[model samples]
Target: MRISLICIGKTDESYLNMGIEKYVNRLKHYVNFTLTIIPDIKNTKNLTQEQQKSKEAEQLLKQINATDTVVLLDERGSIFKSIDFAKYLDKKMISSTQHLVFIIGGPYGFDNSMYDRAQSKLSLSSMTFSHQMIRLFFIEQLYRAYTILRGEPYHHE
Candidate 1:
């Protein structure tokens, strides 16, 4: 299965980009993975929180295909260990999922429509992190999950 991470906006930090790129390259050894960034919304000073989310949601929706299994990265979503997450990916592969799309919403979070469209939700941690920082964190966890699955030394119990 092809795994895609869709996030709203880019990470400006060079250090974070390097870290994220490292895992992205490593992920190729395990599965088909891609990180796609949806450009940030324009002029938000006047828009309400809900309006901003709605605008961002429109961009997010555009990246999705009807066949893709939409998963949201939400703090309130299900939490899993590295092994479990690897198994989760394995199951999706075994089930012949064409494309598994994981989305990281904008600063204001996802809109109700996006929530309704999602097949599942996953949480990296209980504590909140910046949307920019979450990109690196998710990529690292994804790499760790694959390493654990392959019985590599990168992950610990």
Candidate 2:
């Protein structure tokens, strides 16, 4: 199975970009992983929160395929430990899932339409995080999950 992270906006901080890239490179050794950034909406100062989310939703939908499994990184979603995440990924691979997409929405979050299209929702933590920071954290967690699955010493109990 292939895994992709679709997030709104680009990572502007050089430090964060470097860290995100490191994890992405490590993840390539275990699974097909890619991070795609959707451009932020223009003229958002005049638009309402709902309008901004709608624009983001349009962009998000365009990237999706009919067979892709959509999982939203929502604040209220299910949270799992690294080992459990490894097991979840193993199950997806065993089940032959074609493409598993996890989306991180914009500042205002996802619209109702986007929520309707999602197959599942996952929460990295109960605390909130910046979009750029989440990119690094999520990718690192993915790498850790893979290492755990391989019985590597990278992850500790």
Candidate 3:
């Protein structure tokens, strides 16, 4: 199954982008991974936080297929240890998911409809990180999960 990470904004810092790219490239050996960045919403000054999220939600919803399994990277979602996350991924692969889509919403997070459409939600951590930084962290964790699955030495207990 293909894995897609859909985030709302770009990571402007070169270092962060490089780190994200490193994991994305490494992930290719294990799964079909794609990092899709939805363009930032225009004219945020004119919009309320809710409106911005609603707009981002619309764009995010457009990226998924009806058959795709949508998982949101929400702070309030279930948290899992790295090894357990690998097991969780194995479970999804065993279930024959066609495409697994994990989304990182805009600054204000997801809208109600987006939440309503998700099959599950996952939290990288209870501690918060910047949206731009989360891309690197999430991608690295994804790579780590794959390595743990394969018994690679990249991740330590």
Instruction: In angstroms, give how far residue 157 of model 3 lies from its true place.
Output: 1.4
Clashing pairs in 1: none
Candidates 1 and 2: which is better by TM-score?
Answer: 2
> What's the lDDT for all of these models?
0.92, 0.94, 0.93
lDDT of 2 by residue, 1-157 (tens): 8999999999999999999989999999999998999998999999999999999999999999989999999998899999999998898889989999999999988999988999999999999999999999999999999999899999999
lDDT (Cα, tens digit) per residue for candidate 1, span 2-99: 88999999999999999999989999998889999988888989899999999999989989998899999999899998889999988988899999
Instruction: Give the per-residue lDDT of model 3 (tens digit) for 1-157.
Output: 8999999988899999989988899999999999999999999999999999999998998999999999999999999999999999999999998899999999888899999999999999999999999999989989999999999999899
Model 3 lDDT, full chain set: 0.93
The model with the greater lDDT, 1 or 3, is: 3
Q: Which stretches of candidate 3 lie over 4 Å from their true place?
A: none
Q: What is the RMSD of candidate 3?
A: 0.7
Q: Where is model 1 more than 4 Å wrong at Cα? A: none
